[model samples]
Target: MMSLAYFNGNIIGIDDPVIPIDERGHQFGDGVYEVIRFYQGKPFMLKEHLDRLFMSAKAIKLEIGKEQEELEALMLELAGKSGLADADLYVQVTRGVAPRNHLFPKCPASLSITVKPARELSHQVRSEGVHIVLLPDERWQNCYIKSLNLLPNVLAKQEAFEQGCFESVLVRDGMITEGSSTNVFIVKEGKVQTRPLSRYILAGITRLAVKEITGEQGIPFIERAFRPEELLEADEVFLTSTTSEVLAVTAADGRQIGDGQPGPVTRRLYECFQQKIKAM
Candidate 1:
C-alpha cells in the first residue's frame, strides 16, 4: 500500500506539507517519537508503545495534549487506511511552533504521524547471523527518552557502515550500553544477560518480551551491565528492537562471537518472538 501522513487531526498524502519552518521539533529537537509496527494488520504491543511514547513526552516536559484512548484510536484508524498488511507507524509530538529559543514554548504542543510500509530484514541475516562494530556511546544521558535528537546515533551508524557492519555496539566507559538503535544481550554459560534499565539505555519493548519469555521458559535471564569484552567473549550475542526483533550478532571487532553463528538460545528466543507476533 502507498504511504500517507496524519498531521495532527488531518490525514493526507505523505508528500503534503504540514509542519512549519519554525516548528520546535525542527528548530530544537524538542520532541519525542515512537515507531509502532504492524503485523498482519494488527499493531504489535500497541499499548506498550503508547505508554513509552507518553513516558518520553513526560521526560521532555512536553504535553501531547491527547488522551491515550484518543491517540490509540487515531493511530489504529491510520494504520487501517495505510492499506498494508505490515507497516510502521511513526508518531511524534513536539513542543509546537515558536521562535528559535532554548526556553519552552508558550504555545500548545503539536503532533504528527505517518504510516509507511515496513522493511523486512533479510532472512539470511537471521539464518547466518550479522557482524557489528564497536563504537563509543557519545549520546546524552537520557537515552531512555525516545527523543528526536539522533545526531550521535546517526554518526555511529555511519561508522558501522564504513566498517561493513550491520550495527554498532555502543560502549560507555568499557561497558555495553546498547546498539545504535537496539538493546544488546548476551548468553554466557547458558544464562542470558543484558544491561539493567537506567538513563543509559532505552529499555526496549522487545527486550521486555524476551526477558519475559526467558522467565516463563526458565531460561535464566539476568539484568546487569556487561562489559564490551564480555559481549565479545559470550557464548552468544543478540540485539533486539521494534523492527529488528531478535537478531543474532555473530562477530564484533573481527572476533567470532560464540561459534561464529546463531546460537541455540538466540534461535529459540527468535522463534518465540515469531509466535508472539502471530498471536497478536
Candidate 2:
C-alpha cells in the first residue's frame, strides 16, 4: 500500500503530498520537526516529543499555530489514517509560505505530518553492533534546536556510509560530541559518561530517559565531554536516539571497542528501555 501523509489538514499520498516552493521550510529550512515512534497504534513518549517540538519552535520565535492538545489529536488522527500500528511519525512546523527572504514572514506557520513504517535495525547490526568513524563537527552552535537545517549531519552520515560504517561519531576540538543523528555515550570504569546538555548537541528525549532509568536503577551516569583518546580507551561505546534507542558501537576506525561486542551495561540499559516502552 502507498504511504499516506497529512499536509495542512489534507490526507494524501506521500508521493504527491504538496508544499509550496515559497514555504519557508523548503526555501530556507526555517522549521522545527520531531520523529516519534508508535507501538500498537499508540505513540510512545508523545508528550515529551511534543514538548521538545514546542521548545524548538519557540527557540526560533515561530508559533506552533495550534494548541498542543489539538496538535496531538491531529497527529493521532494522521497515524490512524495511515494504518500504521508500528511506525515513525514525522511532524514539522515551518515559518510558513512567503516570498523568499531571510527575515521571518508575517504569516501563520505551516504544519506538515507524515507517517511511514518504522525501519527496524537489521539483526546483524543490533547483535553484532556497527562500525563508526569520527568526523569533525561542522554544524552551527545552536544544535540544541531541532531545526530543519541538517546539511552537516547529512554530510557526516554520507561519509560514514561511504566508509563502510553505520553512523558518524562527531568530534569537536578533539572531544567527542555526538553522532550524526544520535547522542553519544561511553562506558568507562563501569560508569556511563556523555556530553553534557549544551548548545552543541540536541538534548535527545531518549538520552534523557536513559539517564533517568540508569539513575533509578543505580547505574552510574555522568554528563561530561570526553576526548577522542578517552573514547578509544573506554570499555564500550554506544549511541542513542528516539528510534535507534540504545545501540552499541563495537568498532571505531577498525579498532575493537571492549571485546568488539555490546557491553553488559548497555544491554542492561537496553532491556530497561524496552521495559519502559512496554509499560507505557
Candidate 3:
C-alpha cells in the first residue's frame, strides 16, 4: 500500500518539507483538521467528515479557500492516488504561510492532505478489551472544534500509553468528558449513555453511527453527562472514533469494569459496527 500527500495545489511525498517555518499551523497551532476513513476504497461518511471540517474552520475563523465540494473532490483524488483499499485520509487547513505573529495574516489558507493505510487494532486486544486511565481534561473550552491545538491530548495519551493503557479518558469538572481521541460511552442495564454534544466534547461521526445503530436495534441510547465514578461502575464501557470504531474498555484507573472483560453489549455493538462497515 502506498501513501500520498497533497499540499496547497500540488501533490507531494508524505514527508516532504513543503511547509515553511512561518506557517500559522507550524508556528502557532492555528488550524483545523479531519480524519476520514475509506473502507474498501469507499469513504464511510465523506459528507459528514467534510461538514465537520468546514465547521471547525469556521469556528476558528479560518477560510479554507476551497468550497466543501471542491475539498471533498481533492481528498477523493488524493485517496485514489494512494491506491489503498482501506485508508485514513487526513485533511489540515491553516491560515497560510506568513511571518510568525499572534495575529492572523492576510494570506490564503493552506490546505494539506495525506492518505495512509488504515490502522486497526489487533484481534486479541479487541477481544480481551483494553484498559484506560482517567486524566484531567486540560484542553481548551472549545473541544468541539477539531483544532490543531492538541498538546493536552498528546500528553494525556502519552501518559496512558506509559501506564500500559490503550487510551486516556478525560474528566472535566468532575465529570467524564471523553477519551484523549475518542468519544466515551457506557452501557448499563442494557442501555447506552454518553455525554451530550456541547463545547466540551466533539460530535463524533462514529458516535453518531452508534446512536443510529442503537435506534435501529431497539437499544436505548441516552445523551447525558456522567461522572468518572459512574463510568467505573457501569456494566460496560466503550469508546468510538474514526479509527477505534467500537472499542471496549475493561478497566479504568486500575479498577476492573463489570467482569473485567468485554461485555455482551459491547461485543454486540462491535459486531453491529462491523456489519455496518461491511454494508458500506
What are the Cα lDDT values of the candidates?
A: 0.92, 0.91, 0.94
Query: Cα-based RMSD of the predictions, in order?
Result: 0.9, 1.1, 0.8
Model 2 score (lDDT)? 0.91
User: Under the 3 Å rule for N, CA and C atoms, how many clashes does model 2 have?
Assistant: 0
Q: Flag regions of model 3 displaced more than 4 Å.
A: none
Summing lDDT over every window of 10 consecutive residues in candidate 3, give the lowest-scoring window.
14-23
The residue-by-residue lDDT of candidate 3 on 73-161, one tens digit each, is 88888899899999999999999999988988999999999999999899998999999999999999999999999999999999999
Task: Give the per-residue lDDT of model 1 (tens digit) for 1-280.
Answer: 7798888678999999889999999988889999988998999989999999999999888889999999999999898888988998999999998888899979988899899999899978879999999989999999999999999999999999999999999999889999999999999988999999999999799999999889878899999998988998999999999999999999999999989999999999999999989887
What TM-score against the true fold does each predicted structure earn? 0.98, 0.97, 0.99
Strongest candidate by lDDT: 3
* Candidate 2 or 1, higher lDDT: 1
Please, what are the lDDT tens digits per residue for candidate 2 over residues 46-97?
A: 9999999999999999998899999999999888887877889999999998
Clashes of 1: 0
Worst 10 residues of 1 by lDDT: 1-10
Candidate 2 Cα deviation (angstroms), residue 43:
1.1
